[model samples]
Target: MAGTLTVWKFPTETGAETAVATVRDLRRRRLITLHDAAVVSWPAEATKPKTRQLRHLAGIGALGGGFWGLLFGILFFVPLIGAAVGAGIGALAGALTDVGIDDKFIEELKERITPGTSALFLLTSDAVLDRVLDEFRGQSPELISANLSHEQEDKLRRAFAE
Candidate 1:
């Protein structure tokens, strides 16, 4: 089955880190199948976000550090360098687009995950949506983006609304 790439934004800098435990629990319960996960935490006083890949939890077919590095570079570093590195960043962004993470998704992430906020990036498949979402009821995470069909996305939005 195809995996879904979902990004969830949280209001607090530590929220994404806390959510990792919840995701682990869900995986343990067989409610979700996680291929890989990463957390991006940006503190209010920091100049840039801190990224951590859940290497211990990575399963087969997981994306390597290079993928995450290139993506994070495009999202957080490319703009800072201005036009000098535009060509290189463009090629990296294009590679990400080839894998379903397009410019719109990157832009939205850059806009939403600002200082004092955090985001959880999940590569997963075969989720028991209701059960898994129930585990995150009180966290108030916003579903920023997802590689899901229109119907699936609508269902996810409705679930979050509930």
Candidate 2:
């Protein structure tokens, strides 16, 4: 099945969590199929960062979970230290290219998703776009990136941008 990976950025961590909760509702209604998802948040007063991965879809062993773990580790965890450590993580990120997740995606996310904000990384298939978007009618969440066809991507961009 064809899958789409999208990142939705919100002004606040709670907003992102609310969006994710809506997605869970969509899933419950059988409007979408989610292969994996992750939430990354950086609260303004947080002494520590917060991240959550939907483990229900991870299944047995470490395949899906490990992928998100490594991705988030490079994106969130490694930066707490020095440039030297970041260099090593950069190398490790290059290796992830084989799995269709690359350094560019991570870099774009890091640059766009600022502190005091949160983002939802969604891996989904067979989604009812119209209905799903309807759930977000009042809110304007930035569409960071999506592995989608030009036409479909443009549609989603316009929808959310509206």
Q: What is the C-alpha lDDT of each candidate?
A: 0.78, 0.69
Alpha carbon lDDT at 16, candidate 1: 93
Give the distance in Å from residue 128's predicted Cα in candidate 2 to where it truly belongs. Answer: 4.0
**How accurate locally is residue 67 in candidate 2, as Cα lDDT from 0 to 100?**
61
lDDT tens string, model 1, 46-104?
Answer: 99999988887776656667667777888887778879687878976775655567788
Weakest ten-residue segment in model 2 by summed lDDT: 153-162
Give the best candidate by lDDT. 1
Backbone clash count for every predicted candidate, in the order shown: 0, 0
**lDDT, model 1:** 0.78
Model 1 TM-score on a 0 to 1 scale: 0.86
- Considering summed lDDT, which 10 consecutive residues are worst modelled in model 1? 153-162
